[model samples]
Structure formats: structure tokens, C-alpha cells
Target: MVEALKIPTTLAELEALGEEVTLRIPASFEEYLEWVDKCEFTIEYFNNEIVIMGNASYYHEKLVAEIIFCLKTIFNKVTGFSVLGSNIKIHIADLISPTDFNADVSVVQGNPKFVTLPSGKKSNSKITNPVLVAEVTSKSTIAHDFGDKLLAYKKIESLQYAIFVSQYQPFVTVYERKGIHHWELRDYTRLEDSFVLMGQQLTLAEIYKDIQFEK
Candidate 1:
């Protein structure tokens, strides 16, 4: 493993820095399993750089739970597709992505796989394919969660839509992947309107119902 270069700006610099990026020293997969069992902090490792995610707020948790519950109930009635919460893992290998970089909620096509090994370890990461994914944004991660991370997720072939829920406003931004290489952007600011995705639609007023927070 090489010493990772500090964040570089130039494309040439970034290309040069890539060689210096500390690739994960191949460790025993079993040992990683043991570490996962004991680790406490929710972390994400991408391209060898580790990112520590901050804690979620009360409103964040509440909104996440409500969305998952609603999706579970709705999808259960329409099809066998299931809704999974942050307890699941989504990983992209050599990608130096994160660990427990939980989406507020995700919909998977089949039985849930709790431990999704990195692409380097498995033929296909368990969470590589998600019908829809949601993130409850907070002040601490408004930028990355909405910008850079969203860009990374866009690279995923199986992701259909990525959602951003803001704490400052009732508005939500939904990015739906269109065709094969494009995304359709839609904004919902009206409290009465709802955003539809994958297969189900959820009203903003209902999703944020009874919840109050700093304006």
C-alpha cells in the first residue's frame, strides 16, 4: 500500500495521485468479517480513502422510518419487492467507498442480503442493484450527500432514482435516471404534491407529517 496523496486539484495531479493512493492491503476476508462484527463507527471506504459519516438527527431518523414503512406496505401490496433500511450494506470495490453508508431506505428485488461484500471479493456486490434509494440530508452532509455522493451513485447501473431530503425546507429533489444515460430532475416544493418513484408515490406532506424542526 502506498501513502495516499492529499486531495489534489488538477486532472494530471489526480492521475499522478492515484498511484500514491493507499490501496487497501489485502487482508483476510474472514478477518474483515470479524472486524465488521466489532466495529462501532459507520464508515465508508472509497478508492482507499476512509470517510466517517456523522450521526443522524431525530428528524432524519423519523423521516427514514416513515419512508421505509410506507414503501414496505406499498410494495408488499403491489409486488414481492421488499424495502430495506440502513441495516443493509452497499459496496463498490476498489471504489474506496464507505462502510455502513446507509441510504435512508432502499428497495431490492428479492430476499435481502445483510452483508454485501465488496466487488473485489464477490462477483457482484449484494447492494449493487437497488430499485430506488433515498437519503435524508442534514446540515453536516448537505453537500456531499447531495452532490459528490449522488454522482457516485449515478455511476451505479442498477440505481433508478436518488432522493435528497432537506432539513431547511419542505422541498425535496428527486433525480430519476432516464433512458440509459440521462437523468430527469424534478423538484417538489408544494406541501400537497408527492414524488413518485420505482413503482410507488409518496406525498411530501404525508412523509413529513407531524414532524417539526428548525426552519
Candidate 2:
């Protein structure tokens, strides 16, 4: 854990760290927003701490693009659905520690409901409603993405599906909400495998398309 005060102020300085870093500092959400806004890279808020996100690898970006394309293709003709990229921020409220996260791919089934930051600033960048969220996991972020982040996403009232896709391999884990507190889990490893979300089917081949994994 790094101290927020010791963290670098510029994107270049932070990128010099060469990996994602979590800093613990006592600061208001307003300050966090201001700090992150100054940097060019992605930054996430979790439990009052700020996580300086690492740069995406080639495979990671490829997978993200593929997933977004597949999702958009599936919901293209559907009414009231939009697929979003990683740039959008998701506000996970009602938790002991509210979080602001950026998913690799997110799907909103209705007109997006935006929210104001704790600083009382209104921005379309922040969304509180998403029906589905996807994370492209890497070696450094696999744990947090699977653990605390997944739990926080499940808390979102509008969220019904959470998908975790591996960048290094052809594997994916999907969690479907079954009840108020129950979720059904499914894993897909083969390219031929597919899953249904919100009545639309997506194949693993579509997600891993154009991505090559090392043997």
C-alpha cells in the first residue's frame, strides 16, 4: 500500500511505477475526483482509497474491443440499450464504502441514469445504472476484479450480469443474478461455448476474436 500524498501527480510519473498501485489517504470524494481528473490514465475509487490503474496490454485491449463489438452487435436493433466502453464510470452506492469503478465493457438496458459526484458536480461520465458489466482481467488485477470489485458490482440494483474475461486465455466467468441475494455462476472455456444475457446470446469466439494467446 502506498500513501496518497506520496503518489505522483503526473501521468508520466505514475506510469513510471510500471504497475497498478493502491494508495490509502484520508480525503473526501471531491478531492479524489479532482486528483483523478488531473491524470490521463484511469483511476478507481475503492473504500476511500485510490487505485492507479495500469496500462492495458495488447491482448487486454483486443479482448475489450471484441467484447464491446459483440455486445453492440447483439443489442444494435434493440431499443433502450447501449454498450459503453471503459471510459464510463460506474457509481456503486449503498455499500459501507461506496465505489466508483470503470468496467471494461458495460451495457445499460434503459436510458442511462447519471449521478452527481459527492462534490455536487453533475457529469455524464458517472452512471448508476447498468444491467451488465464486464472486466478484462490481468495478472495484476485478477484478484481485486474477482473479489471486492465483483461483490461491489453485484450490489448494484440494476445489475443482472457480471462477466470476467481472461486476457491470457480463452476463459470467462459469468455470474447471473437469480434472486435478491442469489447468483448463478457459469464458466465458459471453449471457443464454441456461449452464454445468454438479457435474452441475447454471445459466443466466446466473439469475445476472443483476433486475440492470440501464448502456447
lDDT string, candidate 2, 15-34, tens digits = 67775554446555666777
Q: Residue 41 in model 2: shift from native, Å?
A: 1.2
Best by lDDT: 2
**Per-model TM-score on C-alpha atoms:** 0.73, 0.92
Looking at model 2, how many pairs of residues clash?
0
Give per-model CA RMSD: 8.9, 2.2
Once fitted onto the true fold, the runs of candidate 1 whose alpha carbons sit more than 4 angstroms away are 1-37, 94-100, 111-126
lDDT of 1 by residue, 1-215 (tens): 11232322234543443322322333334334434444463434443344434456677788788777767767876775868777656654333434334577888776544444444354223466676788877766677677656777777677888888776678789999987799999989878988776667788887677667544
Q: Candidate 1 — which pairs collide?
A: 43-99, 44-98, 44-99, 45-96, 45-97, 45-98, 46-96, 46-97, 47-95, 47-96
Q: Model 2 off-target regions past 4 Å?
A: 1-4, 20-26
Query: Distance from true position, residue 182, model 2, in Å?
Result: 1.0
